[model samples]
Target: MMASNPAILPGDVAREIIAPESYAAWDPLLDTFDHLRDTMPVAKVVAEDDVFEPFWLITRYDDVMRISKDNKTFLNNPKPVVFATREATEFARAATGSNMLVDSLVVFDAPIHPKYRKLTQDWFMPRNLKLIEGEIRALADKLVQAMIDAGPDVDFVKHVAAPMPLHVIMQILGIPEEDEPRMLMLTQQMFGGQDADLSGSGMENMTPEQVLELVSGAVKNFEEYFAGIAAERRANPTDDVASVIANATVDGEPLPDRDMAGYYIIMAAAGHDTTSATMSGAMLALARDPEQFARVQADRSLLPGLVEEAIRWTTAVQHFMRTAAQDVEIGGQQIKKGDWLMLNYVAANHDPAQFEQARSFDASRSPNRHMAFGAGAHQCLGLHLARLQIRILFEALLDRIDSVELAGDPVRSSSTFVGGLKTLPLRFASQ
Candidate 1:
């Protein structure tokens, strides 16, 4: 049988890196990806199971940067930012008559993508976020107080990290405070499908097909909810992100239902989780290395670097998929047309050639243009908002938290995508 196609090529290493269980097995993946970055650089993932596609796993700093920046050749349209499980892909195709990928800015390529992004582009600009700084700061302060009230030993994820970003993003979207819980639940189900603890679907006995149904159900709920919001906003306009989506028009036409809802969902899901993960990682880093915490506490100027470092270190939004439109060569490997490739941000961020001490957490590393927020055209739209939130929160945190240390072994969400610690138990010397 043609020698069984030689198992395609990059072997068990690639498989381990993307494996869902490996999400909790953090250090092993770091080590494996580090080896691949150093050795293979741009390696084709040898596909063993039929769950994932056989494609290039660009591990090096240069290769990832190139692919991420060159959005045209490696298009995000059709199949964007993730290699879906075969079942999910088929489900989406059958249900929506499209790929399982959601069509947001991250999922769209040029031309149409730019126009769609332009709708709320100004709203997310630094100037706009600055206008709402006071509101966000007040929200952050309230969350800090809530954390303080929770007392000596608290699950940081449950008390602070999770709620803080959810509140901020919800406020931005003009979502009622009461609806925050619903938003959180839907987001968890969407991105946390791999982690039963976070998915809340009791997925242990469920097969992949069952989990996909759970995920599909969640997406349907989001779509229905956003549709109602879109109608309400159009009828009675408001100043929040929801209103913007409702009134948003592309080339003189109202945005398609899916894109509008996808935009809202992306902001809701991505807005909180990435920020929460980074915050969790930052707190974890500070607890581990008190010296760094003290230094940041002393000089607040280090807040920006701390945020950047945390994003790179955590890499919450792990990988994005791209489809090669034509034959292309990257890192000396020929990428055939229509092949799906994963831009492994985790590996790229830790490439030793790009970062001097890529493994160690360093807040002083200047010129740190890590691909944590991604790069080029599709770089995170909420990057400025995420940065501002982290910067300000740390400023508030360092000022209030007299001391922070881990109270127990932290637990990470078991997911290949959007994974982070679900529970970061910590003992803090409250201010």
Candidate 2:
């Protein structure tokens, strides 16, 4: 049963929730979420111009966690897993006959999702990741040395954070070093297309359809490029994750072409970007607070906490959409069947109810149950890898750098999806 009248967000606020530009101006967006959490935590967001579909915005920590953990009640399919404009939704449906352009683990439900996820599940586990520890550390050292050589002033995001995880994940996928730039560009266009600086495609001036077309083109390029890699791995199987996916069997049969491509795309794009974002955020936080930076540097044991706090503080993947399977009561409101919901991770991670001094980054914060990597079945598969990458990179950074401070204003990516500091200028001295 529905309520006589569901709460609706004001037009300006609703627009801010969906506007990509709002995310770049980070503090203001958090202020918006703070206001929403106090007044209308679960209000409905209807686009003023009807450009996008209407959905309930879940702003509280408990509500977002509940929805994230209950994948069945909150279905990922039959709707776009990520929010899409009406035009973009139709464009995806007409092209792929699905609500999303990329049909990866995030877009799957039930039986299929678990089956697909198990293919490389062990490989991402901490124990299995130990096999690549040296490789990751070496990459970290090289990047950190490059940062030192380029110091006392450098763009940490450009020189260190961005390339460390990108190189590591590329190696895990058996991608040659030469082809990494192409992969990076495609990933930016796919996830950061809303930002002109990231996409470099002038997407801010483009219509939704035009922006989507650019994203689709990036997907096509990825498929074509990975298609050849898949062929090579199939004929000559190796120990890499790419080979595992290429030769994986769901039900005693090889995976379909689309599913295989989807698997590769997710690994190639997500495996790196989210980790990079967290790394950049951690550095930015350390730069801003020299005491915290010195504390972690002097006490190596605090590295893990720093990594975890960074993930929570940055919350790179801001929000994800989930559709209701049936009518239900949540947050003192009735959610009807098939209603779309936005699990705003940014809000959940920053909720005062869940975290003390939610706005501030505290490495020592215990019981840190953040939804940055999400939860339940669709929780990020590479979470352990992400943690490992950040820990090792920061370890190298702390060992090499004696002190660090901000050189200029940091710039966040204008992406409502996966985003972090795109530019982190810092002045540092070598130990």
Candidate 3:
């Protein structure tokens, strides 16, 4: 028999594990995850200050994979799918009458989750997305050309990383090119609410209520903006993702306004940031390792590994919280019914047992079972698009990018979840 709570993390370690600032520094965060994996791979995160509810923190590769595959036992519903502070959860309850702020695909359980996810699932598959290959390549080339123009020295994030996926996803959504910046800003505020750099809200010294208010306001804007699109699409339906969503039905009725809005927000907001993060991460990894960059540059076939390793290296989605439906055993530890669990992708992806020299950013790492795009039934729907976007972007880059290296310190976003590099300074020379 295993213990009910295997081991509780020390107060300082526990707080740092959830702290937004701690995530900003990559080394310390990795150190914390490493320590957890070594000591209590399946430990309880008991916070005395109660910043968030107590949950089981799953740090090992095997445990996270098992929980992800057994979705029936580990539920996304009845809990916040993504991590939420106790204050934020209570705030959401009072405001939206739900435990979550948005009931998107990320929050739903099976039966309902499958039905909603199936709506746009085909739109993201490789067979369907292949039709847009030319468009993706063109966009990728354009961004790379922009990068070339910005060099011999430039900020890759601005010149290339941010815009490629933004344009691609926006194109699929039928958003006009000019409004992409506005879309980017809203998405940043929504996901990066806690990070002052990402939110642009100067969120210094803000309380939980204030953060909720700010995020709520952003969601409102997204809803209002998409509401008009939803109405227009219903009136004049076209062959776009938004049109599919606008006219989509479940149980013989149109999706409710809130659900419909959630669909739009996921497509418009959640689509690009992760890809952008991976793109920046790819550049960062290559910029730091010239030999690896040269290898990929010369071979060209290693582009897939480059793309995948970047996703794994970045592990941009961070962690998603799950609620245990019944008492279960995992990693020589015990769990109980109704217990919350944090499935940390960062720790799982970087686990040395799963990946050789996991922290070294090996662009050639094969069989890379990274959970950056998640796994099982709830795996990221837009993964093909992400891969295509990254592959094409790097294809264009490798063609012209003679060299790239760090110019100044790269800064990561100060956020507990859904974040990556805020600014990456690079010095590059194009042939």
Candidate 4:
């Protein structure tokens, strides 16, 4: 769009940016980002194999923030909202007849986005979330007790982090308790398919085509499951979020089948997975820093800071793609119309320019304006719920455990998209 040949990222760096394994090795990825932000903050990434389309990688904090807030200039549609290979993109288009595999709020822009978001926006706000506080706290306590009962040593991610938020969101959606495991499995396959351990699908040994097939299968499974829920809610409406979506209207007409399925899938999957990742991250950080954990345990007020810092520290949703609607200058680089850009949250959140001592897990960082929940109209709808879940879980955890330390080396999920600790082995002493 700009020139016949634009400056391309170095092969090694470009590979690292797109590689799923790179995200699991967190420090090195951050180091790569640090180097990029210092030298070429806005670099074009073109895969060596040409598996994926070229997109401008935005690593600097200010530039990412500007692009995120300026959704008007950077539209989410007509391109995959998340990074996808050319093959995967084609598969999605062929399957759904749309740019995305799922046409949810994350992939919409402008006139349609606001309408869909408003349907459940009030339900996710702080005041409304407060109505569910008791329920969430009770669930947190139950999970924390179970963790304590099994601990002295336990995998925190398995015992506590993963299930607590899942249960809460499921309850809110009016899903039966028996179906949560199915939901969790589908979510992992959808978002964690790159990681063999998480997906349980031997993805490491699979070809790209095989991996795409596995993910598409997961999406199909989700749609089929939600279809039943939507039908039931339509027939017998309830106060749950599912009923809200089932009966919602756009321009006085019911949501089309695809949109309805997309809505349910995003809510059911994203509602807990991101929160689970952040919770595990917070526990991992505190387990590593005994002093910080002790300080938060003593001062209940610091729990808020701990939660906020963990969201910034983990940045579960690693990156989201945006398409340029018009020619513009960003971070001293000219972006041409229709060009794709990656808003790398992990890079921006860890940028030393924005956060002093960026790598350190400091719970007391005032004005921790991190891009974890993103910004502007597309900001995560489940943010308030995420924060609340983390706070309550930690509150219950600290109340029951006198001390906590790593029992073994933690393992992170190898995913370029939503990812965090998949295994967090910890030893704790009961209070």
lDDT of 3 at 211: 80
TM-scores for the candidates = 0.96, 0.98, 0.98, 0.98
**Backbone clashes in each candidate structure, one number apiece?**
2, 0, 0, 0
**Candidate 2 lDDT by residue in tens digits, 1-431:** 44568899999999899888898998999999999999888899999789888999999999999999998799999789898989989999898888989999999998999999999999999999999999899989999998888889999889998898889999999999999999999999999998898898987799877898999999999999989999999999999999999999998999989888899999999988999999999988889899999999888888889999999999999999999999988887899899999999999999999999998988888989999999999999999999999999988988999889999999999888898989999999998
Candidate 4 regions exceeding 4 Å error are 1-7
Question: Which candidate do you rate higher for lDDT, 1 or 2?
Answer: 2
The TM-score obtained by model 1 is 0.96
Instruction: For candidate 4, write residues 1-431 as lDDT tens digits.
Output: 23444556899999999889999999999999999999888899988778889999999999999999998899999799999989999999999998878899999998999999999999999999999999999988998888888878999989999999899999989999999999999999999999999899888799989998999999999999999999999999999999999999999999999999999999999999999999999999999999998999999989999999999999999999999999998876789999999999999999999999999999999889999999999999999999999999999988988889999999998999998999999999998
Give the CA lDDT, 0 to 100, for residue 145 in model 1.
Answer: 80
Looking at model 2, report the run of 10 residues with the lowest lDDT sum: 1-10
Error of 1 at 171 (Å): 1.0
The sequence of per-residue lDDT tens digits that candidate 3 reaches over residues 1-431 is 58654788888888888888887887888988888899889888887977788998898898899999899999998989888888888988887888887779988888999999999999999999999999999888887888777777788888888888899899999888998988999988889998987888878878778888989888888999999999999999999999999999998999999899988998888899989999999999999999999999999989999999999999889999999999889887778899999999989998998998889898779899898888899899999999999998899899988999999999888877887898899998888
Candidate 2 TM-score, true structure as reference: 0.98
Kindly indicate the candidate among 2 and 3 with the higher lDDT.
Answer: 2
How big is the positional error of residue 248 in model 2, measured in Å on the Cα after superposition?
Answer: 0.8
* Candidate 1 displacement at residue 23 in angstroms: 2.0
